[model samples]
Target: MRAAPARRGRDGADTRARIEAVALELFAQKGVAGTSVRDIALGVGVSEGALYRHFPSKEKLSRELFLTRYATLAAEICAIDAAERELERKLRAVVGLACALFDAEPALFAYLLIHQHEHLGLVPEAPEANVVEAVAQMLRGAGVPPGRVTLASAMALGCVVQPAVFALYGRIKGPLAAQADDIAAAVMVVVEGQARG
Candidate 1:
């Protein structure tokens, strides 16, 4: 029997990973509309056609990148919400996780953070894969009224997200994790104040 032809390295899983990493960096640096398929192909040292084999279009790649990573983070938050009893502890854990992710994977985290509005509407409302819904569940578990959960969740999430945004822009210095406690506290204020009102 004839030996099977070897698979090209550039057409393998490693190439897909490289394409995603480079696409993320480019998308974060230059808005999704600004980063072209050619830019990603060049960054990955592959032909544009090769990148297409991995992702049919830049929009599809961006969508997959945003949805998957966002779902990962949302699932983690849902896990924390499930494990922690109190709102305070859950907020702390969520804030800490966000900061740690931002510090550890700035490009991936920044891409998710900066481009949320562009893709968030496409995200399902399931708490297991939606951070806002997950946080709202936490608030509701703590006795926040149904009417206020959405606004409260948004406010509390902003406590962590805004600082990350500031850090991304260089307005804030040092590791984002360094400010986790303060951010978590601010989140509590939002939750507690919402509960009171």
Candidate 2:
């Protein structure tokens, strides 16, 4: 039996989504500067004109990817923050959720990792987008002084982000959910030590 012919979407939303997905995947595998409209169009099985119809330029596509992905991750963080009480529990839950997000959408994860320095400025500069602020607030609630909390928050965040970076590179084995407990333990150690000092 032969496979049926693919159905092209009429609403245009499907094509737009496919363009973004293929573009992000290509950008992740090959840097955004390295990938072209033709490449994204080819990956999506559409014409370069169709890619342009969805995104005016490759830079525009990259920016859209960042804004969309960052908003999604920010919402997930907010949900975790609202439900969890303790600092350690919140940290673990966020990290575990982040890992799952990364696992499910590695291309978006890689795109952000590769373009962070260039693209972070474009993401909304809200408290929800700032992990360090969340950590600092948690520290303040736990009795750390305001000025000192920033440093501790930064350090604690390193515990969560650095391992995820390594995991992206295949240096760390298995799913991130598996490492949530250890990551939380390490983060708490850093936070608590700074609180004591």
Candidate 3:
């Protein structure tokens, strides 16, 4: 019997993903500055050379991981069907999605939040800007004032979502999940208030 040839692309992608996952776990446990490529390779049961083949350097890998996660989050947020729903429902949907993402990958969220300032400079500015724009569009679709849309979006994201994530994952003692509904409701109130007056 002839042996089947390995699928190079699929195998390579799997290996790369494994390397990234292991690297992220290590980075989360030990701060990025404390983790090394050799450590990542060892964790993934690959040689340093093999790891380098997938990611040229640790810094490059970290940046790629950060941007990839952020892009995924932005995509989820942008996919909300705000135009098809009531403003309250839309706001709840957005908040629910944000909470689910944070809960699903709290470690990644924590790592990104903690290191955002340092890694922000490395990411393409467009994706983050696009997230803000998407938020503005969603708010506009909800009948929020054009002038207040950006501010409302910023407050929901920066004040509400960010703190909620930290409270959920950080050392701060609080029932983040318990407060999710209230937070969503509060955000909706702000949006509705802006839309009405």
Best candidate (score: TM-score): 1
Q: Write the per-residue lDDT of candidate 3 for residues 90-192, one digit (tens) a residue.
A: 6677777766656676667666776677676655545333455666778887778888887887776774556655674565455455567887888877777
TM-score of each: 0.92, 0.85, 0.80
lDDT (tens digit, per residue) of candidate 1 on 1-112 = 2333345543487889899899999999998999999999999999999889889999999999999988888899999988998778888999999999999989998899
Give the Cα error of residue 78 in candidate 1, in Å.
Answer: 0.5
| Model 2 Cα lDDT, one tens digit per residue, 24-109 | 88988989888978888888998898778878899988888887777677766666767888777877887787778777888887
RMSD of each: 2.4, 4.9, 3.2
RMSD of 3: 3.2
Runs of candidate 1 exceeding 4 Å displacement:
1-11
Report how far off residue 14 is in candidate 3 (Å).
1.7
Clashes of 3: 0
Deviating ranges (above 4 Å) for candidate 2: 1-10, 130-144
| lDDT against the true structure, each candidate | 0.90, 0.77, 0.73
* Per-residue lDDT of 61 in model 1: 98
- Best candidate (score: lDDT): 1
Q: Find the 10 residues in a row with the least total lDDT in model 2.
A: 1-10
